[model samples]
Target: MQNDIPVAVIISDNAEKEEDDKLPEHKKIVADWLTEEKRRYGSSLEKREREIIREFKEDPSGVRILIVVDKLLTGFDAPRNTFLYLAKQLRDHNLLQAIARVNRLFDGDEQHEAKVNGFIIDYSKNAKNLRDAMALFSNYDPEDIDRALLNTGEKIAELERIYQQLHGIFNTVRNRKDNEEYIRLLEEDVVKREIFYELVNKFIRQFSACGMIHDFARKFGEKKLARYQRELKKFVELKKIQKIKNAEEVDFSKYKDQIRRILDKYVSSEYVIELSEPLCLSETEAFNEFIEKAENGLSIKSKAEAIAAQTRRTISEQYHKDPEFYGKFSKKIEDLITQLKAARQEDLKALLDTAHDFQTQVQNYEDSDIPGELKGRKVYHPFYRSIVSIFSHYSVTSENICLVVTSLYDIIEKNKIVDWAGNIEVQRKVNLEMEDYLFDVVKEQKSIPLTIEEIESIMSSFWNLAVRNR
Candidate 1:
């Protein structure tokens, strides 16, 4: 074993000679071999050679294989460890757990191929019939025993079927040559996009499994398998682009190498597309360039969506600063997208021009009629909008409404302490004071009488807005 592969053997020391003497002849021989092997390895005879096994498990560069009997099978997990030689007869959960030691998914650090699956060399012929071994768990479910393992051919067939299903979902798209057609088709129906995602995940899992099985290329012909892999890469790139355009999170570092393998082998280097870095919304020139590049690369529909998504994200982040201004932009962008989709604009150049114009408008937004007193005050903006929303129905002058709302805003701001929303006593006091001011002062001075229910409703809206913007 040492000549061909780096190997270590682990077994019980059975150091007590009198206790060893009482054991069976076979057991005594095994114990003696363990003791001699430990001496040969020049390891200290402390803790029954546990330290040596620990070193062996940790340092994969030094030890390529480990031979063990009745130890280190359970309570051991090493992602880099693959391949097990099972000589001992293990049954039930013991057998399942033993094989699982090597079944863990492992991605190689810069130097090695990933450990996709564990291989078992069954010298004792315990796993010759996997079904019989798994049959022991029939109490769990008899049918589950067969589902525990799938041969290479079955996995390949399932992958092919899933790939076909993905293509079938996009059958309405007539032009397969244009990549944008694929994106547009998916964008038109959210359900189809979701199904595509689900199928792609299933396909990837099976593709990774196929890497571990022997003679996969032969079972699933080399040319056909290569085509599937190339298509899978394309789908993955599309998904990445969609995620980025929507401001969705894209973290694939764990599966990066596995994906790279498919691209490196089957896909052409020149044809491979990488996801662009995230857009910096604060930089005007950089942002415009990003949108221009997106226009050139993606379809008209996708370009519109990408711009709209970024605009929406910007509005969400800056809404607290200027609620009324950003609110209008949000509504305008949403309306524009609805119109574009309804028209089905196919002229890419026209679409890009329209999108750029909208992007410019969003960047250069200015509030027209905001009172000069509330211009730079962030906290008062939401209060102003809330007031306009509530009192616009009544026949009252804008000046008088602003004056009364400003007073109400001042009262709420003064009483708000740490977590005032959560404090019932604080809320009760604030609500009563607001009611008194609105009914007594505003009703008498402004000649605008409000009912009890109206006062309560206005107070609720004011406090809620204050809490959100505070």
Candidate 2:
């Protein structure tokens, strides 16, 4: 019956090359349905984007279609974009952002309408298994939500019972526990704790998205667990209101806000701290040394120290000019630049100036800093080339761009030593890694919230395999 509904399928990628395409034809078909009515919308983007955006602009009854393989997943908007057919596996903030595509309001649509209207008709077999994953954080009630989930109703009901049992155990503990209630409490604690942990593991199995999991985990598992009680109570209250059919314009704002607060708290406390601390420490140490040396009243290091520093700088410059080196780092830089250009609201001149600065630095390094060992024989500069490439990819806030370029320069100065024979290879390798470091900083500044793991797997992988080769 669901498939029997009149649906317009949109095909963005060539259906024949299903494996080669990022999204399969089946999934792309759903994406295409959402954007089928192109001209009805204000302006036309790529035929691909139009296909995705059109569904929102014009309402064609019974037109329940699917789209396959498209790039309009981000930076596009449509109020009628109520249904998001997610065939893709997403993680971190990306998962949230993608689903958010359908969360915007329509004319009479209020909070719950906006929230629940964002449906995902998932045909992707893998995606079906992961349906309950996001619901844990999105405050989605398994029963209230439609056949949105792919598994058996009984399986989902069982999972709910387990959660309910855990809640009951928690309630039992709350009811008693005098000074002498040690043994029973401890025994129950172990059982309850196991259930709690198992719930977390099961949640993870359903939702690969950490932003969703970490957000819900803290609410249900960590600090102020009373909030979870409150939320669950609210869920019960909402079900009653819906059942009465007398609830006019349900206020999901309070509930949505509570969940959002939990998410923010989890992100700030759990995810960001553990993931970023180590990298931040390393970057700070390297930057601190550079700042201190640059700031010293005057400069006349001991001969030994000067020799060591100069040799290191020389080796770094030599490695920068290596052909293999350029082969590796150039395209990542360009991709970074392109993303900046696309995302940011900056003046053209300012962007060009930043690009010029990167270019000048690269040229200067090539001509003056590259070691004589690799001179006259056509050496490449992957680090500098990468800088240029990344600059091209993104259009960033001027201040952010300034910070990024300065950071890139600092990384080169601190890590790369062109003259040192002993450290040339090491410096070169570090520069290669710096691409990853610089890319993350730029992405964050652009307000693109990605997990370090996602950054490494998606953006970094894209950089290394596609950008570098191109």
Candidate 3:
């Protein structure tokens, strides 16, 4: 309900009939509403209640909040429940049972929503009720009871502790202003990188949560708060740098809204993070400029790492555009990396040499190793590569390979039509043409010994690549 998400409210159909009470129709109305999703369901209300509860327990997007006057306050158990908003007054065992709803631990899910602790917002001024309930219903000491609940001031203290820990990692650098040094240290090892990511992400979440409190802003003051805002920006840029240098898929989905809140609250719009994406290989000047602008103290290995990461990223993203063509170069670069990693000697210079070659190759992919006849025919290159890949294991000579590729290209060019990739009719026609040519021309006329199964496999790859190319 906080961000336009739907909240679920469950009313017990099991409530005792109150003939003497006002609003006698309330229970039935609520029961009908519970099952009234989409339309009024014909199923039993209790079954529908269990279904919603199950959804809330398992799905991150399901049932953000629960409003219940009774029933569920007792037997309902969901470890994923992280927050409880109490409005009705209850004491002793009932209050204790309600408080226990959110006390369980959950070690994150696939959506990355982790629950280390629970929160309770007492709207009914339940301070006295909580203390009284503990004193009357529990067998615990006074100070022990006090430890169970904390004041809002503790949130500020926790935020400060996380901030200090996050900055403590960078204290080794004499020049704190040198962002490259901090990023390089993060890239030094995977553990440090993970710790940095965890701490900074926690800091941002804490800051976002506490910023809503008026006292938090007043306590930190304007200047100190501005400094923290800048720190958020710094963390964002460092994340971007690490992602590109490591070629990791960092999930920023969790912080999308929180980051927008932090930036929009500031006076200047200059604090915005506006970079398009990871540098694309096709854009030479921009990509080179990004690589050249690495941190000041980074070694030659770091530059090469950036190039390799970007090259891999480019191949992965653009592979679909021309899989047969990109597939060839992708294999070459990965083989080079595997070879470098497996080498007995640490020949980083050689690694750097290979990485630079891959970078240039990505930018000039169409210019190298193309068949003589397919040299100016860039549109036919991917198909030609597909043909080459299919016949690569055979003893077919280079001239014979070119001859097979151009013949298939002519067959495809003549049969292909508008939107040929999606049109089943066009694909069927192309497949027939390819199969006939492979059997009639490639098998009989050229004396190639390819099997029917091999011909089908090649045609399958071609059509798949054709769909992607489209």
Candidate 4:
């Protein structure tokens, strides 16, 4: 017996109303256990219950089992809660709700097991026949209920099928065992990679569910399952790299523990590198070191992807403030990636050099031509950049653009109240005033005739920058 597992026992409460305070025998047992547990932590009963629930939801070692009868059968959702021990009879909605407690898909992370399927250990003998227990669902047909609960054997079979399908996608790889080969193969074929990833995810889910049932692993063969786990871990690592390079957000909170476990079992410490946090482009040394480490650790294509993704993120953050400067780098990075992909003969050294060169360009952009005084004005800088970019193309001089932008910036800043972005009426009034200033004062004074479309475009750009930066 695993006594180390944390458990919450939900027994029947005899008290029907707030005035009635009678307790049942099972409730007393549960209460005594809670009291003993609380003494160790030095918390009150109410405080302890809250802690238990929190731990059950978050910390893996905190709570292992929740023994519930009536309470938490519905309206309670804890994705990490993997098992339920049923000691009381349940019917209809009650049974459906109770079983659903463990059905949540959980990603395995550092602290807990990846929840595959909710398990029920029935001691009440009320759910002996699956159909009989579910027959009370008058609203749903028998086929619907059957679809919800697949037997262990059926789930195992599905897992095996998916595993095979995943391998079949990688048949083009000359060396299936080579991690680099698999990475290259996946990078080249977008459709195949997508299918492989989807199939493997499906396989992991089914495999995890089947793992809870006794003799299921034996029936599937432990050797084969271990092989799948090993291959899955490799694919997951490659997937992470791909995601990072593509600037895709990967949420690993639920599955981090499970992924860590797989890597610990199969991969060496030298190979186990956690994804680096978002790098600050301003910190030249740190950013360079990040790129260097990535170059050393990853394939050329992977390194290129990571650099491009990070550069894109940097541009996205600073683009509004210095659109002209950052926008150029954004286009440059995009072109570099496109050129790299189109190259027939891949040169690792050349790719690495080009990526570093791009990083250098991004870092050195502060030296770009922008008036020194306007650089310090954070809020107004974006409007100035927008004005410079829009008007500089025509007869409008830099000196005149700066003067008009400065005045407009002052007028907008003064009128912008607290939460002005949320107030549409204020925005409308501000827009009208800015348009009047642009056309009446600036346009007439500078003798720069503008079309309605051009005026609207410039105003729209300036207004958006102001609101977003605000």
TM-scores for all candidates: the values are: 0.65, 0.21, 0.60, 0.70
lDDT of 3 by residue, 231-288 (tens): 8877766876676666665555445545666656663433333431334445655655
Question: How does each model score on lDDT?
Answer: 0.67, 0.40, 0.71, 0.66
* lDDT (10s digit) by residue, model 4, range 1-470: 26676666544443333232356776566566655665875764455556767877877666666655556666788887766777777766777787877778766654455666677777776454456656655555777655665477777778778877877887877975565677677778889878876675565566656666777767878687678777776666556555555555544444554444444566654444343133344565654464446433456666676677677777787676667778878888888788777665557558767766776766554534567666665555567767675676677766777787787777678788888877888778878988998899877877777768778877787778777777
lDDT of 1 by residue, 1-470 (tens): 56876776666455555587688898888777766766876665545456556655565455666777666667887776767777767776778878878778765543333554666766665653455556655545555544544467777777778888978987887876676787777777888877877676566656766765678878888778778877887777667665555645544444444566555656544443333233356454665455456433576667777777766777777675556668888887787677666665566456656666666755655455557767665456666766675566677776777787788888887887888878888888888888889988887766677777778877987877776666
Candidate number achieving the greatest TM-score relative to the actual structure: 4
Superposed Cα deviation of residue 208, candidate 4 (Å): 2.7
Ranking the candidates on lDDT from highest down gives 3, 1, 4, 2
> Which whole-number lDDT from 0 to 100 does residue 51 have in model 4?
72
**Total clashing pairs for each candidate:** 0, 54, 0, 10
- Lowest-sum lDDT 10-residue window in model 4: 12-21
3 versus 4: better lDDT goes to? 3
lDDT for position 31 in model 1:
70
Judge candidate 2 at residue 409 and give its lDDT. 45
Off by over 4 Å in 4: 1-5, 15-64, 69-81, 87-115, 122-155, 216-226, 260-297, 309-327, 344-354, 357-381, 389-397, 422-461
lDDT of 2: 0.40
> What lDDT is reached at residue 22 by model 3?
40
Off by over 4 Å in 2: 1-4, 14-52, 92-94, 107-117, 121-470
Q: Model 3: clashing residue pairs?
A: none
Error of 2 at 383 (Å): 86
